[model samples]
Target: MILKLVSYAGNLFGFLFLTLSIASGLYYISELVEEYSEPTKRFLTRAIYGVIGLLVSLLIFDKFPFKLTVFAIASHVLYLQNMKGFPFVSFTNPTFLLSCACTVLNHYLWFKYFNDVEIPPQFKFNPNYIPKKRATFSEVASFFAICVWFIPFSLFVSLSAGDYVLPTAEELKKTDDPTAQPKLRKRTINLVRVAINNVRGFIRSSLRIFGFKIAEPEYDRLSI
Candidate 1:
């Protein structure tokens, strides 16, 4: 019962992790599209080339299982198609739909491969002679993290949302009601600056949680 409960919990956690990772990856892509559409496109183009090259090399070497190799090749091809008009497309676009299909197919194929039984062809009469093939939780998790699921997550991150744009300071200033624009006013710091400060704050907070006392950095004031 305990082992079963643990297995169930682990599966739940893994599902949640994948869901959160995909969501964050999408959000990161959305933000990139809002801020750096051109750069994002260039990066995705470069990535697709790398992926294609890698897939070709893998096919030539045939290091992975035949089924997985075929899936990888197909996934890369779909990824290449996704690079077309990348930063601009409705969710209903054929390329987007195909990419989504490829992502799920690739993930399922990998999962199936990982769970595959390696029974010998000659051991049909003796079932007990066949060796058990079991993957540990860590091995399965790492495989998904580094290989199977990562490609789709990366594709999600590389995609740009052409419809979304950061509001300009001029646009923010155009509001007649001052109280209504309080949030805009509060955003005085640039996104980059806020990100850096947030990172610093997180690091400090983490150190504090670990019982480590860290002195805050002091900036020099100009004496004119």
Candidate 2:
């Protein structure tokens, strides 16, 4: 019983540590991308072309199914449409939503393909025969990291959330001031930051519901 309890505690700690680590990494990447938005946009555009080329090559070599390859290429084309505005991405935009859906669809299609085993002619005739092996976890994960999730993940980090909220009076005054330097308000809105803020607000609200008084800080800051 002691060993089982210790094991459970260790697993819980490890899971929390991993979650924090991933969140920190994403936050860092988003900040870095915001700082170099132009360069990141250029790199992502080139990456899209490279991915499309790779898909075409795979199709020509018969490495992947024709329909699957064509679909992947088409999806990449749709991804290009999202890049027109580059760093400012509206979550409500149809193109962005469609690209997100395509990402999931591509992962599902490729995963199913890789998971299935192609039986030999002799094995096809034998009803009792079963394949002993399929694509390993590492293989599938690597494929996803490189080919499937790369672009979407990069986009998430690079793209800023749209300024959906109305500007305050001070902001309007700043905009009106001829001597004041123009600020890229849109670029300042990081998706990771927005997500973190929302999560924090939710937690605070939940705590209030439980009769816990958490002091709301003036600036809910994140260490980049």
lDDT score, candidate 1: 0.64
lDDT of 1 by residue, 18-72 (tens): 9767656654555555477668668766766676676567667746676677767
TM-scores for all predictions: 0.51, 0.78
Model 1, TM vs. native = 0.51
**lDDT (Cα, 0-100) at 123 in candidate 2:** 88
Clashing pairs in 2: none
The C-alpha local distance difference test score for the whole of candidate 2 amounts to 0.82
* lDDT: worst 10-residue window of model 1: 184-193
lDDT tens string, model 2, 20-123? Answer: 89888887888788889888889999999998897788678746789988888898899889889988887789999999999999999998888777787888
